[model samples]
Target: MNFDYTLAFAKELDQADPLASLRKDFLFPKQNGEQFIYLCGNSLGLQPKAAREVLEQQMANWENLAVEGWFEGEDPWMFYHKELKSLMAPIVGASPLEVCPMNTLTVNLHLLMVSFYKPQPGRFKIIMEAGAFPSDQYAIESQVRFHGYDPKEAIIEVSPRAGEYTLHTEDIIAQIAEHGAEIALVLFGGVNYFTGQWFDMEAITKAGHAAGALVGFDLAHAAGNVPLKLHDWDIDFACWCSYKYQNAGPGGISGIFVHEKHFTDTSLNRFAGWWGYQEAQRFKMEKGFVPEAGADGWQVSCTQVMPMALYHASLKIFEKAGFMETLRIKSETLTAYLIFAVNQVNKELGFEQFKVITPTEAADRGAQVSIIAKDKGKEIFQQLVAHQVLGDWREPNVIRLSPVPLYNSFEDVFKTAELMLKISKEILI
Candidate 1:
């Protein structure tokens, strides 16, 4: 579909957008008395207006009930995460029994690894993306070390072809086929954080399984940004943080998915805690760990009610907006418009110096458009921020702008591009 990004066209698009009113539900950050065109949802999402009330209610419960709040509050702290299962399940395409809200991303990754990363005598290797997020790299490295394996020998780090910014799907499948028998686990980010490329989860899972390895995903960037089918894809496990695209505030609760096939696998070992013990026997002060029946079995500690409240607030908005499908439609169009405008600017500048590192195909990417300005990249980024076009800067040279469909508009994309063109001519040139 051809998009004419004129101001009138933008206005007309907004006028017809069914999700336009959802923007008013968020609190946009302002600078110089004007709202910034927020394109940073890939880093941190704008806070929902409902989050204030949700957080306040938790504060009120704490003030009135104190320690008793665990069982006595309106939304009991003891079972706080339970309230989020239904809301989060659909977002990730999993059954409620397969999903659980819990610890931070890396922490949950480690916990899931404990159960999923059982390496046999000769076949104990882990496969992952080479430029994975630092936290994930550290976690995987530490897990290999903790298991008395040399990471250099036991971990396979897949990289893009020389001089490429993204990994090709064919390369990934070929790699799996070549080393499938020796691999124990295949762990990768569902959508790479830096490149904003969405991997083929189902395809990856199938390849891993065909090679006799368990598969998992670190969905920190993918969750709420791209549509997922964890259960249907037959993925073994997955984990994600809520602070980014989920808009659940900083360091909010993370989530996990454990396939039903592993639900009753007693041989699948885990680092158990009291919370993971069977609820009926939990209060009995049991001597042995009797795990919960499904994904909830992975819980190691009690839920943090405050952060759970914040997550609830955001999930409510997701539920109201019809979740992934609706947001995805807006996200694809908005990102396409931003890409179009940026390319136009580069053409007008008479130099194809700006390169979009993120994949052009909508199915291969999410909302983020990662651009590398060949020269004066940082200067261009600073100019964009100064012009109230908020984006994030990665090391060396990438400028990542994410047009979150829930809060960002087509006009915001237009104005952001207009500002970029102005900045490039005046300062970057």
Candidate 2:
């Protein structure tokens, strides 16, 4: 699929896009008077237009039904999460019973670790990627410390080879096997937040199991950005935040997946609460905690109505767009065009001013394209924003841009690269 770096070409592509109408479903941010070319969906997705309507409905329920809203409303708050499970399961490739929307990502990770991260005499270590998102690092560190083990010795970090920015699959597998003997769990992000590299989850899961360890993923960046098969992959557990690619609003509700195979395992420990108790007997205020069947058993508290409403709005859009596989087709082409446009910028300047650090293959990456600016990176990024080309900047010199298939058109990508080229020229001069 050859790509041209012309606005006319971009418009032509957008004109033929089947999902083009879906763009109107969101409200883009504005700087000055013009709408921004938002390429920061990897960091924070734009708000869905339906967000207001859904939120108001829930608010109205609170006004009209009062406390009885839990059971009396059209969409009862008591079983609200059940409505979401069917929508969310398709995003992560799981059955309805295998996924549940509950606590935030790290919070769910902590709960899952309590059940799966059982460190024993010979196996007390956890293996993970180096430079993981700080929350994961902190959570794993704290968990190891809580079990009376020093993090330095109990955690094994797999790093990229010298001078390389992304990890190789074989290297990751080797690390798992190398530490297999003492490893109790293997955890990794489905797609790295910094590099946008989509790790091979099935491969990792198989390796983790072969090494006699439970496997889990933090899919904060991967959910709705790429196609996942958590259930088919035989992953032990996984969790994700909905704010980014899922577009569920800032600090939106998070979800968890526990394989159906683990559903009846009574030996598994959990921080139990009334919300997770057997639904029929919950009103009886039973003595011992009896967890509900399936992934709902992992719930530590009752449903979050407002946040779930926000998430439902976005999931409906995904449903309208025909879910992840449909979106992935556009995302691959859109992301490829981004890489091409950035490469064109460097070619026109007769120097590699912007270096793309993400994997080139669509199979190994998602919508995000992280680039390292060779000169005046921060200045260039600031100017891009000032000019209404909104992308995000990381520490050091990386600028992250994500052309979300659901909202961002090809013209948005083209215009952003054009502004970046102009900014780079001005900064270098």
Candidate 3:
């Protein structure tokens, strides 16, 4: 598909889009009394218009039902999180029993580590990509230290080859094999938050399992951006925050997936709470902690009703949009167009003024395409923001832009490119 960066072409494609109508689902942010061309879904997704009603309904439950809201209202607080399981299962390609919504991403990561990342005598190392999200880095380091080992010896970081920005699959597999003997766990982000590189989970899982290690993923950026098959891939455990791609508001509910293969593994330990006690005997407040049948056994607290309501609103929109594969189709074309338009700006300058560091291969990346300006990346980012192009900038020299398929239209991408090219001439070039 040859993409044209002309104004007419952008508008024509948008006019013909089947998913165009879906943009109405979100409430785009306005600046100077006009809507900004928002391209920061990678950081935080736009709010679903239906969110207000969901919140209001929850408020009504509080006002009308009072203490009885726990079990009597339209959506009872006692079992509200249960309602979201089947709705969100398809987003990560897991069965209802294997998935549950709970604590934040890093919290769930800590809980899962308690069960999966048991470093023993011979196998006491962990392998991960070098520049993971800072929180993940901290979590792994703390976990390793808590086990009474130095991080320098216990955490093995797999870096890219010289001058490369992304990891090649072969190198990742080789790294796993090289350290296979001493590694106990292989934890990775489903998509790198900075580079937007989507790892091959199935291959990674196979390699980790063959290496006699358990595998898991932090899907903060990948959950709604790409199709995943946690169960089919045989992942041991996984967790994701809903605020980014799932569009559940800031610091929204997080989800976890634990394989049914671990359902009866009594050897595994959990930081037990009454919420994790067997449902039928939970009210008895018994002395012993009997776990629930599946992934819900990992849940340790009462559900946060409002946050789950916000998440449910977005899940309904996801169901309305059909499968995640459908969204990926539009995301690929839109992000590819962004790459082309960014390149065209450089081509017009008769040099590579901006280099896109994100992988060009569709399978290797999701919605974001990270751009590095030759001389003025920060200035270029500021200019885009001033023009109401809502993209975020990273440290050093990278500008990250994501033309989300949900709320961003082709014309938004076109206008962004036009403004960027114009700004390059007026300021950058």
All candidates: TM-score? 0.98, 0.99, 0.99
RMSD of 1: 1.0
TM-score, cand. 3: 0.99
What lDDT would candidate 2 get against the real structure? 0.95
Question: Worst ten-residue run, lDDT, model 3?
Answer: 420-429
Per candidate, the number of residue pairs that clash is: 0, 0, 0
The lDDT of model 3 is 0.91
lDDT scores in order = 0.91, 0.95, 0.91
Ranking by lDDT: 2, 1, 3
**Position 420, candidate 1: lDDT:** 81
Per-residue lDDT tens digits for candidate 1, residues 1-429, read: 687757787778788888999999999899999888899999889899999999998999999999999899678888878879989999999998899999888999999999999998889999999899999999999999999999999999889999999999889989999999999999999999898999998999999999999999999999999988899999999999999999999998999999999998889989998888897778898698899878989999888788889999999999999999999999898888888988988887899767999999999999899999888889989988887888999989899999998988888888887788788899756
Among all candidates shown, the one with the greatest TM-score: 2
Q: When superposed on Cα atoms, how far off is each prediction in RMSD?
A: 1.0, 0.6, 0.9
TM-score-best of 2 and 3: 2
Q: Model 2, range 189-249, lDDT digits (tens) per residue?
A: 9999999999998999999999999999999999999999999999999999999999999
